[model samples]
Target: MAIDGFTTCLWFDGQAEEAAHHYLSIFKNSQLGHIVRYNEAGPGTPGAVMAVEFVLDGQKFMGLNGGPQFTFSEAVSFQVRCADQEEVDYYWDRLTDGGEEGQCGWLKDKYGVSWQVFPTELLKLVTDADPAKAKRVTEAMYPMHKIDLAALRKAHAGER
Candidate 1:
């Protein structure tokens, strides 16, 4: 496929190929592109995978085996907007396998890449015109590792 927009590059110590495969298995609209290997390059063993390109849900990403000097941090994260609770649960469960859960629907995948997975309604609830309603929804989300859409809706509606 022709990549038209900016492609995200993930820096990995030596798991470029493995990470690409992991993502492929999770996203339905995904496919593997090219696998670039080192050729006589002194930095890595010849024929070893240097980088892997893949598409996840139409977004292009490249996994680079750039060594251990660089690592993924919370400074940057990808957000997954789910249509409903089931979508949120699917991503949260898969991405958090052998990984960590952060407050407010944030998580670090097994590869250390941070992600924000939540229902699409969250944006609407948190930004509601009614300040109190929005505040309640935001408060309810504060302590959650995986967002619960029903709970958030109840908070927005001022329900006990």
Candidate 2:
């Protein structure tokens, strides 16, 4: 019973391998892991990909070709804690390719996985002890697709 970490499982219709590769391309410190394929079990096409294991940014994930019974929603999202605006932009641009952007630094990738890409500074600004500053920063975030750290800072400072 040595649980060091948890592996997130992503359910896909039939694109587990493709999804794994797509994620691997985005993260620099990532690599492919084991790939399991269906055989005579007959759940999926014989020889078709059943699951793919991959590590992205040191976190383990599994993509399962579990058919179309389930889907990803905004309720569950991966948060990318960026060091600065540049990191935020990098992730936002890459993840939003062939995907949809949502308000407040959220986006759904081509594989329909939701992600929150925001600067780490956002947490500090929005949690400031000054209630008005915190409120302003949070309000400024509402209309943003990709977070603008400078804008958030301005809002936090009550600058026009």
Candidate 3:
């Protein structure tokens, strides 16, 4: 079989359809796909969502309304690279609606999904050819709860 992109399967207690709709609204290129329901061979009640396929920014994911046995954690996260500080701030504010914020540009969404909203320029500066500048960028990045591209650039340039 030819292997293409892998679909991330998320197990929810009973909010698969709602979550799918919410995600589709957030991302630019997203839509809900096939929603399979249970008949008799599945777990939980007989008419629940067995699987709901959704596409977010061209990435496909499958949500299963399985009984609550496991949950999402910070171990896995999705990163959104933004062109500027405004873009970063926009996503950060929207994604952390009902979730906690972590250090270094990381935030949890209302669904408990971890997300990293970062500026594209920050990555470029961190990977610059100058090792000392890169080190400065690294140091600046460590103490930040939310990523500030201007601060990172100042640090990279050996400024206060």
Candidate 4:
């Protein structure tokens, strides 16, 4: 059987629709899908959004206006694989607009959503067939706040 893209559900206190719009604006290939509101017999307030389905970069996601019972945590995050340093920098800056930055290319967006904006080349280098090169790449990565591809490449070559 063919498998579609994964769907991630985000729970918001009262801004499911708003958040969906925000996300769609950020991602080039995103758009709002469906808007479902509560009925008299439903769980949420009658006119409030019960859930909003959206697609970001071809990945489906459901945003639920599930009240303020829960919030997002660092444990759950989205990984954006970038082709180069410029792409990595663009996502890293945009995602961390009003949030904190973590080590190793990790960041939390304004909505408290965690994201990992990393270069695709870094993965290949870290998993290189040469054990010494991989070890050097691993060591170089440990001290980084945001990924530096040049530094990583230099590390793999054992250059100062």
lDDT of 3 by residue, 13-73 (tens): 7888888997787777888899999888756667777789999988999988876788888
lDDT of model 1, residue 102: 98
- lDDT tens digits, residues 12-109, model 1? 99999999999999988999999999999558999999999999999999999999999999999999999999999999999999999999999999
Per-candidate total of colliding backbone pairs:
0, 0, 0, 0
On the 0 to 100 scale, the lDDT of residue 144 in model 2 is: 94
Q: Native-vs-model 4 lDDT?
A: 0.89
Of the candidates numbered 1 and 3, which has the greater lDDT value?
1
User: Which should have the higher lDDT, number 1 or number 4?
Assistant: 1
TM-score of each: 0.96, 0.96, 0.90, 0.89
Relative to the unseen true structure, what is the C-alpha lDDT of residue 29 in candidate 2, on a scale of 0 to 100?
96
Put down candidate 2 lDDT per residue, 16-104, tens digits, no spaces.
99999999999989999999989998777899999999999999999999999999999999999999999999999999999999999
Q: Write the per-residue lDDT of candidate 4 for residues 112-143, one digit (tens) a residue.
A: 88899899999999999999999999999988
| C-alpha lDDT of residue 136 in model 3 | 97
Worst 10 residues of 4 by lDDT: 90-99
Question: Is 2 or 4 the stronger prediction by lDDT?
Answer: 2
- Worst ten-residue run, lDDT, model 3? 41-50
